[model samples]
Target: MDLAFGADDSKKRKGPSKNWTEREIEEELKKLDAKIEDAKTNSGDVEVRDAILDKAMFLKQEARDYPEAEKVFREAYVKSGGASKKMELLFEILLMNIEKFDIDSVKKDVTLCKQLVDEGADWDKKNKLKIFEGVYCMLIRDLKRAAELFMSSIATFTCVELMEYKDFVFYTVVTAMVTQDRKTIRKEVVHSPDILAVIRDIPFLRQYMESFYNCEYKQFFEAFVEIIDAIKRDKYLQTHANYFIKEMRLVAYRQYLESFKSVTIENMARAFGVQPDFIDKELSNFIYIGKINCKIDKVSGVIESNRPNKKAELFTNTIKSGDALLNRIQKLARALDI
Candidate 1:
């Protein structure tokens, strides 16, 4: 008759048990736990502790146990005294737990960031904190808090030469809020004076000033100055009347042609880059001389030309006059400068 243990007993005697159940695995884990504790107590064996913590963090995350993962990460972070790698790990873990973490928890992270700041972490790390604060405040629509954080970060780098260019970007953000309604024309807008001061001091800012002023005042200042110069040179002196008229007509024609499908006296004057009254006078003279076959549309305030031959004579006369007029203006400019 066979013995009760039989083949299983023989197998167990020959080697380790092959049919180990969950209970046996648990018992083995308990023995490994004691060994881990012994290693932790050994003053020089930090590698084992780090390895164990790494394994724990990995397992917690892989098992989708965020709370446990975060707990292990925090312990690692604290043990490392907020090392850069540790901070990065903390950031990743916290971001994953954002839905479960409340504002208070985020604020705790912020506090940890402050601690890192106090511990003399790198400026880039501090900037990262500021950026996080800014983004969080923006998400909550807390514009004031966001602005404060941005200003603080700006201040931190203000003394550094490399960061000086950021002043313009910072000022732009602040001034946008200061000058909200340009249409109503508030003389007290903070941005206006600052911009004017910048324009006065910075040579390269001339074009920028022109664009800024055009947007704010709805007037092209440089173009207006050119128009004034044209008027002073064109009228009151018949020396270059023909040249001036031609110059004005060509400009007006090009302007009207380019801007609109149709032309008008006022629009033509605008295109000529001169006062409307001046354009009207010149056109009337052309009509009187039978140089241009044109009709004035009273309804649209436009001058329509029907004869292309008239344009040729008018163009020739205008060119002759414009040359003489430009020469005189140049002489006058030189005399004034002298």
Candidate 2:
């Protein structure tokens, strides 16, 4: 599915509505509207919900009336019966709404969907929601949580309605690379049989992950450029392309720097397949922000790792966190001292 990189592998657009003319679609939608009225008149709630669902789908696909479609979808959900029925109907509603990427609405609907699933929804339904929610998390820039959700659902991916299996694998691997630690990425993404099965089909993405893992910085940098292009083209990731690219470059640079107390700037550039000046400028910005924890010797043209001692860093962070918490508590106490 290389969903972010290219066209979707297959969409669950079930109907000839797309092939029909506007007038033809309008005529067919009118017929479905009549069917909905007939179901309300002579059939059960299930029949009415089914009829409304049909109309909603028609509006979404044929008429291209998303607002109307969503309204009708809500009608179907309202008519839906029991936990299972509501779960099914809600997922339908979710798919339509998620396409719009209305962030606040998605958050609320996903939360509601979670609640419904918790009320004993089937395993299949639960797994499906995980993928949807994972995609939603990715869209919102919560890469860590999105990676967690995506990795958890890989073996049981059945969200064909949401995306193709290969696309799911793509999202899972990309997010894992950025947000997951090396050991976790090795365990959950690099060596996962489910991911390995189709990863080669996504050649650049495979290179992006595997090259970094294998310490092939040259290959990783080559793949990184291709991936940035794909991310720029992706509707879901376009907004985050610059951010993602910068982060990934840092991932490569940090990994390379971790192995050396000091490395010549020219050597570091050669390793990343970039120019010495480019590496110097890149490392300077990161070092200024304390992002890379490194020092650059301009005259000697050497880059030095200034990473703090792990235990000392950890202790400093703990004390800072505790002091911040205590200040907040003291502030509260002073306000209530009366």
Candidate 3:
């Protein structure tokens, strides 16, 4: 497992297996098989355990036989003695599962990684684990945590094996825009030196962040429209594209409407670079579904903010989430009891 990811141009990151010819692959596997068979007697040796794990990586990266590879990986973990060695092998297994997008396995493996990390892994290892956890979160569409992890790891990012640095920033901005409030976005993201360094290279992404925070509604709408296709085509985000877009729109609309008690429909439409009729229909639909807290004066073509009490809303949300968590725990306990 080559984890030397100290490169600015992570584009050259490629698995060694990709370069091996079919004949070479077959020859290498045969050699590894002999070594593995022989190493079984000397399995207590650290070097023998490493060779066993190497064979596991070969199966994972080349043969793509996940079950067998995972079996070998777990066997290697059980035989391995050193904490560092265990963590290294764990990362190998985690990355292999991640490539396959095996969400359930990822969740299980990440929990183990957390245990290993907490016991002895250094700060660098912990930061790298954040990248792994962040990627797992993305696969599961838990973008809020994913955003937080990515943002925190930006300055010390070394997960180019999972995704390039630029792509990491892209995910950070995309998730943060919908999940973070204006103040946090301004402080953590807009002012982030790591984000600012690479944001210009990505198309429409900078505008997407700046316009929203700066209250440039028309630019924000245009930037969002420009980037919508990319979001829809994304591997991790595409599944949640509709949800993400709707949340973003609600955020933008709420931000704008929160500034005023009442605003004319025509002004709102003009602000967003859309027709009044379009705005009317969109707002009506959002309001009807309780996505936005605002009332429309159809006769006067005005939209009035019906913002709820912030403290009450926070308390209600906390209670609801707590109840949901308790329900899940109870169900899991019942399942275990069986």
Candidate 4:
């Protein structure tokens, strides 16, 4: 944990203490604080001051006093002239309390992260900062941006680098599902075979994707339920769980509608494991908004697609074929001219 200060005087004096009580840690921090002040006044050695502050920061974190730890880290970071590790840790401390961060603080950290990356910080640190930005976006309820940032971070990483970030990928997939932006998701997530493989490694993710792809509305809902705890744990998802659930249901309902010329509300309700009333309301919501391109026949209890009639469909297909044939002949004529 004390990566910055590898050697400490206490450790050399009495090997390393395996178990230090809270009182002992507090005492150590008090002594280190005094030494840090003395080093500032007497030796004026920034390195010595930074080392003392690092030990104090470590002890503060161990004592679960994160605000105090952040103060110590900020001081050390200033003395060290913005060392990469210290800068990364500073951002990390902010990320740990993302919900408490204000919009200005979040924006400041984002700018710092970009500056660090431009100055050639390590890949691990870069990805960590990128993930922090994504988490910040999630905390702010900007899910579309969060999904894109998470994708960019993971896309540049090797498989070895991705193991530590499986949870982030889970967040990205859930964001994609919630936003239902298939164009972006397909380009960013599904098209990347390696990333897809990494994603499928999670058992629940695999189930969700399989069921969603196969349009198994019931199975997809079950898969979502299985990961409900995870959704609750995430700050953004927990806040918008109802919205996500509602949107995903519409997606499932639309897919179900694609398979039928007409289906009863009761039957659709059975497939989605919802009450017929709920299905009726959801269908009305989508249909009114032109999302489902369908109508419900209340007397017949049937929901139907407003697709073209057979003759109209045939005429549309013929026009499309003719256009394609004309384009091909133009290409052939150009080749002949060449």
Candidate 5:
């Protein structure tokens, strides 16, 4: 499976797959339908029905009939009344339906997975479920939660042998960058030698991590663009490219704000290679959302950074020191009396 996403700029992430001949597909579907009908008619066992449906789903998937596979998986999962094996099948359905980018189905499956975890599902299954849930959050533009979830699953990724390990690590780094959560990266990603080894080999991921960590905003943006370009060809990621771009831009904006006292929107835009109005709009959004402690002067077209109140901070620190000294003196006096 060549999951190495191409830099395809097309918005349509999927194309027809000639996995099976039409006649072969029709023959398999007919056989699976008869089997399913017989199972329903002769067997009252829900497991038997679910196994038959699963076989039908496999045939659909083999024929690259993703929509039909999704339908069959959903029916089997629901009709089985939450069987454990069906939950695994449901995850397959989630993977197959990525082109549709259905948030509702993802959420429903996440809820079911959480319930399964609570009921003592294996740690490996729980870890995979968490990663999938993080993907759901990313698709929904919840970058902060996505970063947290990805970071929390780092240990699992280290111990587990996942076929999609490359995508998992790539998204982990991407989500952390989008949210600008360096502390989490430092703790969860950088310190883990296992993940570090994997990332060091991948040029783009390595560049992203180094650029972000080294405060090379321009390099970071360039590498980010490359990442986004590659992601655009992926069936699951293309749907959220715009949102991902917006979040990554905010990260760059935040980094720039930290280094300068104030900067004109035009100048910042020029530095970032974007339009002045786009930078202004982003700065305005950050201010509105309380994501950045800054003020935008619309008339001057500059964003002024909100410096901390050093005087107030000094006074608070002085008070804390005084209280600490007084406590020490009291302890000394008690010792002397004793």
Candidate 6:
């Protein structure tokens, strides 16, 4: 009765400890696993399902378990009833695989693209798919196919709401032009007014037109008369002309600089249907403003020139590098923020 309890006896008297052992922790985790499975099977809330799927994907990605991540995405797609967000995620995964340049992966992406296109993906989305196709074609230097796809994407934009689609269209046109396919150029002109405007604005095109007309004056004049008559009869031409003039100046310096190296004032003057003196004056002004470097040929009263800086070249390149006419129209559209 008078004796104090030993430490072991005192511990026994305290009974079981409050802290959980590893076994108990495992048991709790198993219970949580069951609960999560039940929730997944029965959850009607889209947001909750999405959240769970996202968590799973993130965890798998963190674990560097791509197969598991893909499984999660597929489950999410089914669970969410093919939500656009889930579809986008799936597409992004496919895109990443494509970036690896695995031929198998690219073919898979191409198939997916076709499926998506068939599944009523919006025009804007289809345009993106076409861009990927174009990229693939470009990598192989199959420029003709690339240009065709780019043009197709541009056509798709006629139905889409995004301004970026138009930008892509312009870019596609430029890409085609850079490859220097005159047939493609002519086809684009026939199909796209925006392209026509760009062609009309291009210094090289103008020079070509002038030289051609000067060489075949009667036929050129006849065609010119017909065009003028058509424009006079149609109010649309006036609108187009006004719009073209406004945007033409945006690339004028660059266009002039690029063409000046190979084009004479006489060439451009004939192209514009203006006096050679007028062309000379304009050329002098361009030189003064550092838009171009004018090299005068004393005997011929002719000048040769080139862009004095990269900035000017870039502008010209942007305009003329792809589908010239389409790109110009697109640029004009962008400038108007339309």
Each candidate's root-mean-square deviation in Å?
A: 29.0, 2.5, 6.5, 11.8, 10.2, 24.8
Off by over 4 Å in 6: 1-42, 45-49, 56-71, 78-87, 155-175, 178-181, 187-338
Residue lDDT tens for model 2, 70-171: 788888888876666777767776777777778777788789888888788788888988988887887888888999999999899998877777778888
Model number with the top lDDT: 2
Instruction: Estimate the overall C-alpha local distance difference test score of candidate 6.
Output: 0.50
Tens digits of lDDT, candidate 3, 1-338: 12122222224544455667778878988898789778767664776777778889887777666788888999899988756667777787787777667888889988987888778877767888898898888778788999898888878998666777877888888888888887878888999999999888888889999999999999999999866777777666777778888888988988899899999999999999999999999899999999888999989999998989999999999999999999999999999999
Best-first order by TM-score: 2, 3, 4, 5, 6, 1
Report the C-alpha displacement of residue 316, candidate 3, in angstroms. 9.4
TM-scores for all candidates? 0.33, 0.90, 0.84, 0.69, 0.66, 0.37
Across residues 1-338, which tens digit of lDDT does each residue of candidate 4 receive? Answer: 21111112233222233567878887977877777777767786665656666664564445656667666666666665444656555564564355454656777767776787787777777767767777677767787777777778766643222124566667777776666455666677666675676766665776676577667777887787766656655545676666667777777777778789889999988887778999899889888887788889999999888865889889999999999999999999999999
lDDT of 6 by residue, 133-226 (tens): 6655644446567678777665454422112332344345434543434455556633466555544432233333333323443343344443
Instruction: Please list the C-alpha lDDT of all candidates, in the order they appear.
Output: 0.47, 0.83, 0.82, 0.67, 0.71, 0.50
Comparing 5 and 6 on lDDT, the stronger one: 5
Query: Which 10 consecutive positions of candidate 3 have the poorest summed lDDT?
Result: 1-10
Off by over 4 Å in 3: 1-13, 16-27, 40-44, 309-338
- Positional deviation of 184 in candidate 1, in angstroms? 21
- Residue runs of model 5 more than 4 Å from their true location after superposition: 1-23, 33-54, 78-83, 158-163, 231-234, 259-304, 308-338
Question: Which residue pairs of candidate 6 clash?
Answer: 173-322, 173-323, 174-322, 174-323, 175-322, 195-325, 195-326
- Best model per TM-score: 2
